[model samples]
Target: MTETDVVVIGGGATGVGVARDLAMRGVDVVLCERGGLGAGTTGRSHGLLHSGARYATADPEGAAECIRESRVLRDIAGEAVERTGGLFVQLPDDDPAAFDARIEACRDVGVPTETLSADAARETEPELASDVRRAFRVPDGVIYPSRLVAATAESARQHGADVRPNAPVTDIVVTEGTVTAVETDAERIEADHVVNAGGAWAGRIAELAGVEVPMAPTMGVMVAVDVGGVDSVVNRCRPPDDGDIVVPHVDRVVLGTTSTPVEDPEEFSTDEAAVEAMLSEGAAMVPAVADADVVDVYWGVRPLYAGDDGGRGRDASRGFQVHDHDVARLTTVTGGKLTTYRLMAEAVSDAVCERLGVTEPCRTADAELPAGDAEKLDALVEEFDAAGPADTDIVG
Candidate 1:
């Protein structure tokens, strides 16, 4: 039997982050995961460290938060991030009105942007389509999810947290309207409070404690091609849709994605046509990708918190939500982007700490996260089997 002040379910970036935060604040925390750390959504992201330009039009506040967090990640995890700035390019077929709106919204939200002429844009990225209408440079960058997750988990372990991988939480024991313990396959963990950080499976985790987390999971695909010379993250300057967002890696570029709603996150079908569409769409911005060989492809499900009106797919909020269950000590945090995982953890920890009578403030934002050379970081990822499909080419 194991006992702790907090039992955090899900070992992704947010889950480990919660554990690390609470543990640093002197809370006994244990993190349990069904598979390896980041084996879920965190491990399968397109690796864009957003500068918030993508959501500045529709979501200014969220965009602001992204820009703030993006800078913070660069400070804390410099070795894990590639400082490749992002560019939102307008193609010949893209809406001219939308381009104007995007630039205005980003400026209004205090997101630094520089609109570049076609010639200048081509100079920044020579492989850009010769017919490129225009481009906006933003602070977008790439984050290696596997290294980030492994680094955070290592921080949690160093902070005296019981970070357990391969620990499937079978059930959450809520007795008499109070969460008393969490039941896993190996042992029973008696926890003062339980946090459901299960990402897309958050609804299922809540169900175990007799709560409803309205998660409308949306599945998307990412295709990585063996192309080079794309020195920055590239996005289509239009409304959110399929086959946009090109994330550059050291050796290849990852092109994605399609947003289709799904009933079950675990069981969903992928479209091969989506991959072909991504290559075609990607070539619109960077012509070199048109004939590039695909190095990897992976599917990811977004943990969308569907409210009453049921905003589906891209319409669903990319913001995080904290759900307090009928049970006294059960909390579930879901949604939000990989760029803002630290902020999400802070919010989750604040709520849990408030209920637990802990007054310690969050120190994750400014704290220097510990990381090492490539070999050591790779070892951490291997230790947890957390080489996410999208990070396969980078981690090990």
Candidate 2:
């Protein structure tokens, strides 16, 4: 039986972030994932690095956190983040009074936002529709979730952390009301501490440990376009609707998303209706997007841990919750956005270390992650490019 100081469930950003932090602190750590890293909600995100402008009006606290973490992530995870900035545009039907309130709220939270004339906005982004009434530019950007998660795992491994893919934790073994081990398909591993960063599966994992987590999973769908038609991240200056945002990645622009309630997180699918709605709504912001070709459609489920059936996922607090089940010797971290994943990990690692009597402070924030080096990244990208397209021909 293998043994470890900490066993992290889930391989998403939060899980890998915790693993890296603990391992860097000289504590034995192991991370197990049901599938590939970032295979869940992490990779399916909108890729926006919030400048805190989005939540400035709805939730000031959340907006402040986003701005603080956005800067930190930009510095540490340079390769994973692109400083494209962002713009909140007011369309013909949008209320100018609401836009004024949002700008004031952003200023209150110390977020730098500048109002621009419609022509100025169009000058910056040629694809933007001339019908735009007003625009506010903020310090928003883009992030590659897969790269971030991979970098975290690689950093943990470099510090002697063990990472196992396809290792779905089937059961949590507790004796005398204390967690002692976890069972997977292949074998059982003893764990002194367990951190459930399972994203959407967090509530289920907590239930296995005889605890309850109030996660209300909500499904969101995004469509990737082959062309990069926009210069920066464009958002509708009001409440989140079908496809009020267009996020630009390296070679393409992602039009997203739609929020709807779902019974099962794993079974949700992106259909034609969702795609059509995204295109229609997104077209209102940039009329050129109406003719863009969609490359792929994907869906993600946010683990919003508040309210009942008709809950508002985006409206729920973006802050995270860390539950320490002393009896079960386990901790479950839920909620929070992708922008603040590192902070979330630091909190979870600190709690785990305290529970296990490890006095090492978290070094994840300071320590440069594995892929922080540019040379290593170039090599990996070159290798992937050299592999070329896979051969589909196979003999049975």
Candidate 3:
């Protein structure tokens, strides 16, 4: 059995971020993942760096957190983020009064938003339909999830953290209310602290430690199109709904998404109906998308805690919760959006350090992640571009 100061479950962004943060603070950490790193929700998102504009109307707090983290992430992971900005458009039937409130809300949170006329909006994005009633630009960007996860893992490795992929924790060894070790198929690793950051599988991990996590998993589907229809991220200035946002990533634009509640996280499938629904709704925002060539389709699961009203998935608070199982020496950090993952990690690391009596303050905010070699990145892009099909490994 290998002994470490902390054993982190889940190889998604949250888990890898926690591992990197703890290891940077000089804690001996081991991160175990059942599959490849970021082979979960982290890689399946719409890849938009939330400018906080999306949640400005409904959830102000969540919106604020997103804006703050957006700046930090842009500074740290320059290579993974494309500062393309975002456009929130209102159609003929859309309410302008609500759009005003959204713009005001964004201003309150220090997010710069400017209203654009129909012609001006078209000037910015020629592909936009002529019926665009109102348009506003916010400082939004796109994030490459796979690159972000790989960077965090590299940072953890640089700090002497051990990362084991394809190693699933089968059980949590507890003795008299204290977590002593984590048993995986390959080995049994002992730890003084355990953090469950498994995205969709968080509940199962907690159950292994004899604890219950009220998580309601929902699957989201996103389809990518070959046509370079839009340059900036386009969002419908309305409440969260299916296929409301189109994010341009690298060489193509990703049109997403569908929020259908599901029982099993790993068992859901992205069918033709879901794809057709996304494309139809997506075409409303950008008319050219109607004829765009569909390249690939993927799905993601959001782990939302079951609420009092039985609201699941996007209906639940975009906020996160941190549970400190003191007696068990375990901490579970779940929920929250992908844009604020760094802050989530900071909070989780702080809790773990406090439990272990360590007084180190987190410096993850200002830390700059190591970037991939420029030549290597360019070569990878060239290979994907020349591979004939746009669906080739351009993302990973």
Q: Which candidate is the best by lDDT?
A: 1
Best by TM-score: 1
lDDT of 1 by residue, 21-60 (tens): 9988989999999999998999888989999999998999
Distance from true position, residue 64, model 2, in Å? Answer: 0.9
List model 2 lDDT by residue over 288-346, tens digit each: 67788877677888877763443456666567888877566799998888999999999
In model 1, the runs with Cα more than 4 Å from the true position are: none
Per-candidate TM-score against the hidden true structure: 0.98, 0.92, 0.94
- Model 2 — which ten-residue stretch has the worst lDDT? 387-396
User: All candidates' lDDT scores?
Assistant: 0.90, 0.80, 0.83
Query: For model 1, what is the error of residue 233's alpha carbon versus the real structure, in angstroms, after optimal superposition?
Result: 0.5
Per-model tally of clashing residue pairs = 0, 0, 0
Model 1 RMSD, rounded to 1 decimal: 1.0
Deviation (Å) of 322 in candidate 2: 0.6
Give the candidate order by descending TM-score.
1, 3, 2
